[model samples]
Target: MMSNPEKTDLKNLTLPMLERFLQGRGKERFRATQIFKWIYQHDAGSFGEMTNISKDLRTELAETARISKLEPEAVEQGSDGTRKYLFSLGDGNAVESVLIPIEGRNTVCISSQAGCAMGCEFCLTGTFKLVRNLTTAEIVNQIMAIRCDVRAAGEEIRNIVLMGMGEPLHNLDNVIPAIQIMIDGNGLQLSNRRVTVSTCGLVPEMERLGRELPNVNLAVSLNATTDELRDRIMPVNRKYPLKELLRACREFPLPGRRKVTFEYVMMGGINDSLEDAKRLLRLTSDIPGKINLIPFNEHEGCGFRAPTQAAIDAFHTFLIDRNVTVITRDSRGADISAACGQLKGNLENRKEII
Candidate 1:
């Protein structure tokens, strides 16, 4: 609300950094918890609404700090109850988040960058050039916005998937802090298991994530079994490749009883063959993980089509026969272009598909 005020964006600060910010302003460091609660828990958009804090302190905060907002451009609901929100950023660029609910749990898919640079041919997000990495506030704001939306609809979110738009590891500097806030006991209190970060096998970054945030679940987009196949579709594969990528997953310190999730998008005649499934099983044999078969979400110009139902079934059956834990994940929000690998915002420079 402060116009051109020299205040810091409070949402950008981690709890400890916020503690320092409050202390620097001559406020008690513990006050950061209260402010965090107001922003993340109470969903307060402005300092004045934190009525529990002293009015004088509220005025102080109003003058010295601000919470940035993402302008809502559109909200589309899939007939299956999934919702997609398009949020406009300050620079006129936009990003999207998808809210998916299943049975007792509500899962929100959040973006880490405006577009994507991973260049996975099957992903629609890959077509748009990577404009910029989302700041910590921009990343966290998407969750907060979705949180408010879900609560208003009388549902509580139980899971969060960093599976939208860009590669999360590419924006680790901002994404990790946002994840810390999501899993902070004093804040969103999301169980580490409930929050998953999906990546296209950013080997070193994945290792770094293991060291820094070991508790959160990880899902790798292992869409192809062979490096040659992967290289053509996922450029990151050229750098990390399958061997090194799976090695990181194997070495990752997953909490007891937790296994990494291998997300394999089923692209027809590309990587959905029954033999591919067998190879996939062998590829993941050494790693403790489950296979999530995502039938490709099709869009124009992507040049890839979804695997046929029989192909998908045969792959699923092969994995089942091999005694691998496999799940054919239901693709939600395709009706709204909000399914995995299908999110592309309506920025002026980006082509609006759908």
Candidate 2:
């Protein structure tokens, strides 16, 4: 079916926004809650599927609103059970998401934009440049589409991470509401702890996110300990240096035992030195969070190489010796170009050549 640009996407609205929308349409605020449950909980494809709602009201909704859904244009599954999904945005642009299944947890990584503007030298998505920020529906539907697959396999998606193709903080306007829908008790019913928003140190937005969604987990893609190196790898660091970024992390309100996760991507011969490890400890000493040491996932055209197992072990050992909680994450879906945006980059290049 052709998309109706004029029609409002009900999936785009948060609970409060939905309430306002219904009220404006001369409907009771309760109608918004019912619609929310029908769309999210019941996965209603159309207003006609909402049997509990009156036929007249359903007809009214059908005339002006549409439930947006994204069907993946392509899906690549790795031997490790990690699946990468490429979804068309209806425009010329497309975005990708990944499903990572661990022992007890099934995490779906969703994207916030068609491509990335943050030119992190190591990231594949940044090579494409920024296409556009995804709408609320586009972001939310990625989770919904993946959740459908996980549930069919008799496993539920326990975690949602905005660590796919784009910087979530860069698209805060759409990302925030999408997150609200994720943790809403009446809808998706995901625990606040299960959802994570990862950013390459967008300082002001980080503070704003902590203020607005204190319960939701925050992860900073802190690939370097020193600003000099970080600025070279992640261009965003040039705007908001380590001092400003770390200050935001330190000041971020952590309700309960929540600590801001520091995601350090350890590149071989780059930021993997013993000196860098020492600087990392000093940088995050006061922050009440753990460290996730990710060995650089080597990809084509990227000169960066993954740190050796010996180097990774040394980095992990140093942190453990200093009473820091750290976990060296094994890179998943290596055979399937599971690194964020790798599959999309390959597909787009093929299309150009074709």
Candidate 3:
């Protein structure tokens, strides 16, 4: 049997790109909006379902472009209502997206690459080695897929955190356009504040992201207070360094009440000391940001343990007493291994089963 020709993915195109594509085809400019609403609002899966569009245009679109929707191969829901979705890619590899529902808030944690290259000592995903960067479609489709699931269950995804498998800033080209589609009022329509891009402190790309999506929230995983400790755990620090990274955080463009979130993962006997807390307070003292103290989640072969409750409490109290804005963001989806820094591209195992 002959394979069909690859159809262009209209869903991958940002509004401006879609408009340009349609305009090049000698079509009206307003069609982009119509098609966007059909795809996003009406949940039009195929061109035939776009009834408001001209028949000829719909036929042309069917022949030339298509929308690629993600179908989760497997889904595991945590007792805490966090669902981890495994999506198969065209390549034999797979990626994971998470749906975390907290009381009234629905958040989707999406990945940017197949595996990670940053090699953070405590993260499970770093063990797989970097495979490939996901395209804009792959990134956006995660939200679209999760959004559909949320709507089906009578809830809607309100927040998106790019804190899944890989470092987003490392894949800036695809990520930027994906961000455009995410915040586009005519498309996903997510507020910039609701969409957050978490990075392992890629200073230059972080700067570029702020310039492009200034309103989008930026979260930095600053797990260690000392450069020496950080360099050991997060190898990215060896290049960016504490001095340079903090400088970037301080000078990062923030309008109104927006503040950069500094994520500090507390490792027992490592970076959770009273002095460590003091160092962290001083390090971010000049920057306009809040702190999220996350206790490490022990994964098999990762050899890290979550800090004791007393230790964790002490760290949180230290920051609060000093009048520093901080919170302890406990891990969710621990039972399903979808918690922060725990996604390990289990697709290899899925491929074996297939």
- In order of listing, the candidates' clash counts read 0, 0, 0
| RMSD, one per candidate, in order | 1.9, 1.9, 2.1
Return the number of clashes found in candidate 1. Answer: 0
Candidate 3 lDDT over residue span 54-165, tens digit each: 8999999988888877778788888988999988876787889899999869999999999999999998888887999988888988898888889988988899999999
> Looking at candidate 3, what is the lDDT of residue 112?
96
Give one digit per residue, the lDDT tens place, for model 2 in 62-166: 999999898877788889989988777777777778899999589998888877899899888888888889899998899988888988999898999889888
Model 1 scores a TM of: 0.95
lDDT for each candidate structure: 0.88, 0.87, 0.87
Off by over 4 Å in 2: 340-347, 350-354
Cα lDDT of model 2 overall? 0.87
TM-score sort, best first: 2, 3, 1
lDDT by residue (1-354, candidate 1, tens digit) is 123436788888889989998888888888899999988888788988987789999988888788886755678889998888888776767899998988858999999998898888888788887989998888888888888877887978899999998999999999999999999887788888899999999999999999999999999999999999999999999999999998999999899989999999999999988789878988999888999999998787878888999999999999998789999988888898889888887654434532
Candidate order by decreasing lDDT? 1, 3, 2
